[model samples]
Target: MSEPKSYIQVLSPELLGRVFDAYAHKPDEEKHLIGLETTLFSSCESGFYANPVILSHVSKNWRNISLDRPTLWSTMIMVRPIASHIPKVENWLERSKTAPLTLQIMQTIPDDDTPIEPLREERTAVNTILEMLLKHIERWEAITFFLCIGFLPAFAEFPQGKLDQLKSATLNLATWSTHPQVVDRVFRAIHAAPELEFVSWCASFFQTGLPDHVPWQQLKRIELDVNDISEEPSSVGYVLDILSKCPQLTSAKFILGFCKTTTPKALNTPLNLPNLRSLALDEASSPNIAYVLQNLTLPSLHTLNLSLFSDEERSSANLFKAVGSLVGRSKSTLKYLGLDIDDEQLLKLLPFAKDVEVLRVGGAKTKKFTSLLTRNANNKISLEVLPKLEYLHLTYAQDAMRPHRISASTAALNRMVVFRTSQPPATPGLKKLKFISVGTAASSFQTAHITLILGTYSHLNLKSVRFEGN
Candidate 1:
C-alpha cells in the first residue's frame, strides 16, 4: 500500500461535472435524464436532451438502461431508408410498451428524377411506415410532416381547420403541376394547423392564390413563388393584404412574376405597420400601383430582395418608361437589394444603379444588359457605391468573363466579389469576400441561391469597391 505514492492530477471542472452526472441516479424529476435514448433528436427549443444520441455511451451499462423510457420514445424522425431508424423506433415501442408516439415524416426530393432510393425495397418499406404514421396519428406535440409525394397542400380553410395539423413545419414542392395529391395534402396540412409559425415553400406554377383566411396572423415568414408573375404578378394584392394584417410578419419573398402594372406609393391601403424589417419583391404591376410606403415607412426594415420574374411581355421602350417611374425611398434605409433584368430595358428604365450599395442584377436576355452598368460605372463614378458597403457581388449567367478587371481585389479571380483588403475578415466593418458561385447550362441554380445567400454585413464603416462585369 505504501508503494501507491504516485501523481494524482486535479480533475477539471468539466470532468468533475461529468463524474457527478455519471454517479447521480437521477429520477423522474430530471426533465432531461430520460431512460429511452433510442429515438428522437431535438434542439434546445425542442426542450429535452438536445442530442439524445450521446446517451448511448454513458458506459456500456447505459446501452440498454435508457432504452426503456416511453416518453423518450414518443417522438420519431423518419428521414430516409436508413433501415436502422425502423428497428430503433420499433424496439422502443416494444420495450417501453409506451403511450401514443409522435412521428415526424420527412421525405427528401431527389436532385434528378432518378428514383431517390434506387433500392426499390427501401422505398417500399419507407412508404409502409409512412402510411402507418398517418393512420396512427393519435397524440402529437405538432406535425412536422415533410412531403415528398407529389403535391402541395391547398388549405381551403384559412387558419382554423382540423386537417392543417401542424405546430411548426417546412413543406417544399418543386413541381406541383403534375401532382394533384401534393397540393391537396398541403392544403389539408395548412388547414389542420392552428398557428403555423415556421417556413413554407412552393415553387413553379402558373399561379398561387390561397384562401382569404390564411393563418397569416401568427406567421413569422412566408415565401410564395407566384407562378406566371408577369409584369402584373398575381397575389401581390393578397400578399400585401396579409402583410398589412399580420403585424408579426417580418420576411417576404416572390421568386417570379410578371409586372402588369407598377406598385403605387400608397399600396391602396389605409393600415400602418412600424415593425416591417425584411421585404423582397419584384414583378410587373400597374403603372399607378403604389404601396403606402411614402405614407407608412418600415422604420425597422433591414433587407429588400426584389427581382423581375418575367420580362417576356414587357416592351423595351415601354419598360424603360415604366422602370424610369418606379422608385423606393426611405433615406437609404434598406441594407440589401437584388434585381434581375430580362433585357437591357430594365437598366435603361430604372434609377436603381445609384440607390443601394449592395446590388445584384441578372442580364438574362443579353450580355448587353450590363451596358447600362458600364455606362454608369465609367469615369470613376460610383453613384450607388455604398459608403458603408462591405460587399459587392454579381453574376452574369449569359455574360462571360468581364471586359475589365476590378483593381479593388488582389484575390479577385478566386473570389465572387473580392474585398478592398486581403486580410481575412477579422474586422466586423471590413468587406468579406466569398467564393464565386456559377451554375451551368443543365442544372440552373437560380432560386436556390436565395436560401444560401450571404447577406450584407450591417457595418457602418464599409465602402463599395469599384466593380465591372461582362
Candidate 2:
C-alpha cells in the first residue's frame, strides 16, 4: 500500500483541473442537469455526490486543486435553498472567486401539495444568499428562475440595472392565476440588463400583452410557451408586434395551446425575419400557426419544425396547404423539416420539401408512409420527390386510424428501398432510415424483414438503419 501510486497523482494542478473541468461540464450531462433541479436538490443531501465535491473528497492534494479552480464552482444551482444550507452556499460563492456565474434559482415547496406561504426563516436565508450574490452582480453571466407566485415578491427586492455581464435568462412560472403581474415586473427588471441577448419564458397561464421596456431589437434568441396565446385579438397582436421588433433574432420557438380565434389586424402586415435560421412551433392551431408563417419571410431559415395539434379534419387540410405554401416560399433556403402530420398532409406538402436533406415524420402517419415511397402506376421509382433526402425518420403510433395498413406500408417501403438502390449512377437514393414505433403489436418492420429487404439491395451502400419499438 505504501508503494502504490497512480499516473493521475503525478499530474500538475493545472492539468488535473483541466481534466476535472471537462468531467464536471460534460455538455450533454450539463444540459440534462439544467432543468433537473429536483434531482440535483435531492442528491445534494445524499451520500451520492458529483463534480467538485467528489473531486475534493478524493485526497488532500486533490481537494486543494479543486478549490483552486474557479471554473468548477462558477455555476450555482439553488433549488429550494434551505436555512441549513446557507453556510454551504456561502462556501461555494467564496470558492467561485471572480469567475462569471450562471445561477439557477428554483424555489419549490418540499413535501407539500398545498401552497403555503414561505416561512420567515427560509425567506431570510434566501435573501441572505441573494444579497451576497447581489454584491457581485457584475459577474452574473446567466440567471434562471423557477419561482412560484408566492416567492415572486421576495425576488423583487433585488437592486435594479446591475447585470452588466448577463447574457441569458430563463423564467419558468407555475401559477394558477390567470393574470400574473409579477411576470410583468420580472421582465421589466430583465429589460434593465443591457447585455441580455437570449430569453426564455414558460408561463403556465399568461394573459397579458408584451411587457414594456424589453430590449427586443437586441435579442438574438427567444422562446415562449404560454397558454391561450391566440385566444384574444390583443394578445396575438402583441405577439406579432414583438416578433416585428426582433429583427436580429436567429432562432425562435413557440408553444401556443387552444387558439380558437384569429387577429386580422395582426396579420394585416407581414413580418419579415431575414436573419432567422431555426423556427419550431408546437401544439399550435392551424389558423394561428399559418398566420405566423404567412407573415414571415425566412430567407436564411434552414430548419423548421411544425408539430401541429389540431383535431379539426377539414381545417387540418388547410393548415397542411398553408405549410406547403410556406415551404414553397422558403424553398431557396430550407434544408431540414420535421412534421407531425397524417399521410394526406405529407403528400400535399412533399413537393414543397423536395430539397430537404433531413426529414422526420410521425404521428399516425407511418401506416400510410410507405404509399408515398412507392412508384405510381409507372414502373419507376418516385425519385422526383425528395431527391435530395439523405436521412428519413419514421415513427409509428399504435392508434393509427388504419392499423391494418401497416403491412401494405411495409411492402411499399421495401419496394422503394430495392428500386432506389438498383438505380444507375447519378441517381440519389435514401442513405439512412430510422424506424421507431410505439404499440403492443409489432408495429415496425421486424429484423428478419429488414434483413430480407437489405439482401435484395445488397449492391446499394445503405449508410445506417435503426429499429426501435416498445
Clashing pairs in 2: none
Using lDDT as the measure, the top candidate is 2
C-alpha-based local distance difference test score of model 2: 0.63
Candidate 1: worst 10 consecutive residues by lDDT?
Answer: 401-410
TM-score of predicted model 2?
Answer: 0.73
Q: Backbone clashes in each candidate structure, one number apiece? A: 51, 0
1-470: candidate 2 lDDT, tens digit per residue: 58867889788889999888876654422223333234342212111134468789989999999999988888776666667656766777788898998876666644456445554455566667777777777888888766553453455555567777889988765452433555565566677788889977665335544555778899999887655332353333445667788999999887655444664544554567888889987766556677777777777888888776644422453665666656667554678888765456667777667668777765554535666654443534465666566666655444433221234444566766555444444544533333222222234434554454445544556666554432
Give the per-residue lDDT of model 1 (tens digit) for 340-418: 5444544453344333445554445233332323222223332223334344455434323211112222222223232
Worst 10 residues of 2 by lDDT: 39-48
lDDT to native, each model: 0.43, 0.63
